[model samples]
Target: MENPIFKDMLVLELASVLAGPSVGQFFAELGANVLKIENAATNGDVTRNWKLTTEPADTDIPAYFCAANWGKKSLALNFKEKEELQQLYKLVQQADVVIASYKPGDAEKLAVDYETLRSINPRLIYGHITGYGAADDRAGYDAVVQAESGFMYLNGEPGGGPVKMPVALMDILTAHQLKEGLLVALLRRERTGEGQLVEVSLLQAAVSALANQATNYLVAGQEPKRMGSDHPNIVPYGSVYTCKCGKQLVLAIGDDRQFRKLCTILGAEGMAAIPAYATNYSRVQHRQEVNERLSQLIGQQDREGLLQQLQAQHVPAGAIYTIPEVFAQPQAQEMLLRNGDAKPGVRQIAFKVQHQEQAQLTPPPSYNNYKEDKID
Candidate 1:
């Protein structure tokens, strides 16, 4: 089999939860040797105990902990111990990348700060994930960052209070940011033979992810309101219609032509002729009327049959699926990867980079899975 993209590269993962570990996991998938450093004194990463249900199991490690840590080796160390700190410093000197998500000065206190490590290894690419920027000392959590970054403010239904997203969106986005920065830094290192510090924060990621919402506020002075799933600039774009059987069908009518086609499919082609519904801009101005009319008509039909018809007509529509339904999909099933007969397994890495051989992945490691005696 051919070697992976990062065959000889070594990554030292000093981060926990999602953002930092996720970057390590990504490198592991791409064939980098990722060694995750867990604090043995604290029973390792906190996610190991984030159990979803109260039921007892063979290992206390929860699915949350396994999700982003698959395919990496684990080394437990207590930085407070001089020997362990010295060993970690040795590993840092040999590593190509080091990723950590410590609060402001905590890295310095732990003696793993970028400045110290860079002095030890001039070619080490150091990545730091923060809750805010490098200057902010506040601890960053995904939910709190969601609220502070204006994402929560524009999330819930109209006239409703701000709602935090159910997922750790900020952490996930921050991971991608770190991954991109690290890749670019690695490339530059190849040319200059020197590594640089890369930094990403949940606050910065959340703001950058605003996309058009941020542009609307800056360019048009339009403060976004909570519209639930609705798009701010498009009409008939965010409304969910309940069918006769109680399933929700979401329609994404992107342009006038699609809207006209949807009107025709609902046997309300005349609605397209009305001045208020003729164009997307006018429809946005009269979104309530448009949604109410569409919802009433859509509610009269069965969901599956209507979805089939919509698909046949080339309309952009889909059923709003529950979590189970999402995983049950053929596309989703194809992406699932398993090791042995484990009850649950990690999904395939999202990248579509084709390779001659499939990358093999092992289950997440148990605490202190590797011993100090095994170190070179």
Candidate 2:
């Protein structure tokens, strides 16, 4: 969070949950002054109550709420209050950006939609996120969106029931999409001297992220099936192999050469010599045979030793690390963001840039923690 490129900029956050809050946090991490305006009537974001049994029942700052709320000043307001509405408008007059996730018409009802806010400050950038598109108002939860967008259909093992992803995948994807759009909007404002609204929806983000999988159906008339971790286009790629210590490793062999190299490492060079398994296409055709043989060979070795061997040989393979193990790694230390007594959050901006030296990041605020008094 040392990058101060957004220093002195003001961002008003009218969003809650993951996507919009994440966008606000992105600017906050980059040193923008972000104000998170929450609904006081409901006791702030719904995620504040999403906690494990281990978390304190009395606290408003649950770990889930902290996921994207870091480095923000919170002001909880009941929108029905006229004085509070005027207070928000006063701040909006000076704000550079506003990030919101009010479904379709909620913003208009609250008199805080893009048109209203832009009238107060023509230079204000508006970023909005939705469950579906701007028109469809059906609640767009990640699990339901995954089902609608074909992700659930193609995610699990072959012949098993469709499964939703563990994380809020659609929200995360939409957050990234909104960030890209808002950055572009900022650049556009630099040239036009006028701000514009940038909108992204969970359904749009999820569908667009299908990438090659969608092309397989549209261009080639192929219906993608659930193949577990295996890739349909690449032989021996995305294949999960188990080792002696019960550790799982995944391979990402890119081409015939890598497949041959993998075969040599597995003591199965003879398999590569056979016409049915010699090339990527052939190996893909005879995938069951290839996988069975490779599985048997891999199951005999220790995970750490084999992982080292693969790395030394420049093979594209990786351990299936648990969540705790991922953050425990030395390289992941750089991504850590500590904020007061709350559990640490991760940095949203992954890229590095030279900026002013950073002070410690502030933790996600409690409901109405800063109120309107903190605003200039």
Candidate 3:
């Protein structure tokens, strides 16, 4: 029977860890049969033990592995044996795509580079997810990429030392770009009946994902500073006012009209009437003064009261929430943030698949679960 999404395609994933595994994850969700090939000596992906929230009652389940390896089949292979390498080459010949994340020349050393794979299957889409491009020797960890891309410097408070983002934001961002690159190659292959190499670098992806911060620094000579919560160009566009309940809300007024509406909500009519606060530019110039006064005014109200009032005026505002509080939110629940349990033997965790209808949950397989079956 022809598949609804990817009918004839098979994905051979030699990628481990987050960004590389994420590429296979996307294909697995969209009806592609994905075989995740892992090394047997190290016993598979390195991310399996990075972070574990719950102690596994059985063999330890790596929660980090669970986040990136869902929706795919795992197979263990020891390529040091020539027979195993032969088996891998046969699988590559049958696959529509092959994705790997080895260093620049490592894949060639393994005899699994694009040239060798394309010879096996000329129609194979080979994706190389690397830390830097094929030319760079520097290592490419998420924090390393963040610092190299100038992301770490532009975040946090002004004049403070560079702060590393807690999560692997650069890795996740590269995963998104990897997915895009794979999909685009798939589409192109569909039209042309030919496959090509798709390459994504951690440093390049991080730089691309930095958005306007990178552009502003490149085009204009000004380095983007860490302004805490406030926007560089827009006043009243950040965290403001600790409420009586001690909850902080971000009040982002993009223009003067919104500022006036915020003023009316806070009953600061006199402050809105001031000439220096009339325009967004003037307010931005006097942002410290504006933030101080707004903080004082909103401090008188409770969080619930301030949120309700601001929302009623169609202002863009949101209260700072802990992870649990965010999970409890109706909007987050609707968006599938509370994914519950993915499959048997997998503990419940939040997956970032936003669309409920499109979301498919499956537990990450154990590293040793994939064993070779002799073909009849």
Candidate 4:
């Protein structure tokens, strides 16, 4: 699991919370030396205090903080202090990258601006994340961005109120965008022996993720509506049906062939012959009727057996699984990352390289103190 692809790389992280730290962890997983710089004035990253009710009150390093803070060295410094500022300058000399999440004018005020750091190290790649954009200094939270980006409006049930996703999806998406930008920047530097600034904003990332949903609005003027576990374009694709065992199954019938096969499997070939449900377009137009018929047919059989039969017939169908059920599977268990006695975490890197069986994840950094012993 030891892929030292970035073993010689040095990342100086001045970012806090998820997006910036998540990028740091990505490099750390690649065997880079990541130095996480937190502000002493604020008692370090606020996420350190974002503990669940079940967590111990006396602890500063909560589960939320550890989520994206592993495999890095931490430093809490008052940047205004001359000595503390000098420490950062020294790291800049040897750092390959600097990750920051400062507001519009705050970076300049704190002297950690990209212009200032790039002046010290011209070849240093600066990755910056913002809530809105450079023009706006409004603080960005994932929940707020989710609402503003049209995600919340399209989520949840058909008639239900807007609902923010359970996870910090915007931050995660922004981190991924920043990572792709940084990687491309690194590739550009390799070719030209130069470095540049890479920027990502939460609002932009969430909007970018709208993908086809945005296109449907722009191209066809079809305003997206909330349809729980349902797709706008494809019928039977995300439609959930309950079985006799009370278990749920969902179908992803992508083509006419699959739809016909689904009908054959459910002993309802007659339904597919009915001119209205003949094609995907017709099925979409008659969504209610199709769903009701499928519900009745599926309800006559057990979920597990029906799912197996559908798969055997090349029909895309699966059973709904709870979070516990998800991790209980072998493939999910294999994605778990464990370092010492820390609670199990899942790896962010999903794709595998040739001959790469696992990832080498280290322990999360100490909340604020610098661990000189951890330095190689």
Predicted structure with the largest lDDT when compared to the true one: 4
Displacement of residue 182 (Cα, Å) in model 1 is: 0.5
In order of listing, the candidates' clash counts read: 0, 0, 0, 0
Tell me the lDDT of candidate 4: 0.89
Q: Which ten residues in a row are the worst by lDDT in model 4?
A: 352-361
Q: Encode model 1's per-residue lDDT on 1-376: one tens digit a residue.
A: 5678887888999999988998998888887888899988988888988887663565646788887888788899999999999999989878999999999999999989999999999999999999998898999999999999998888898888999888899999999999999999999999999999999999999999999999999998998888988888998886789999989989999999988888888889999999999999999999889889998999999999988888888889999999899899988887676779655655526766665355577778888787654333
Q: What's each prediction's TM-score? A: 0.96, 0.96, 0.89, 0.96
Candidate 3's displacement at residue 146, Å, is 1.2
Q: Give the per-residue lDDT digits (tens) of candidate 3, residues 155-210.
A: 78877888888788887888888778887988998899998999989999987887
Residue 283 Cα positional deviation in candidate 4, in Å, after optimal superposition: 0.7
Question: Pairs clashing in candidate 4?
Answer: none
lDDT accuracy of residue 364 in candidate 3: 70
Q: Tens digits of per-residue lDDT for model 4 on 77-191?
A: 8999999898889889888999999889999998999999989999999999999999999989999999999999998998899999989999999999999999999999999
Model 2 residue 371 distance off true place after TM-score fit, in angstroms: 3.6
Candidate 3 lowest-lDDT run of ten:
343-352
Kindly report which residue pairs in candidate 2 clash with one another.
none
Off by over 4 Å in 2: 1-3, 355-359, 372-376
Number of clashes found in candidate 3: 0
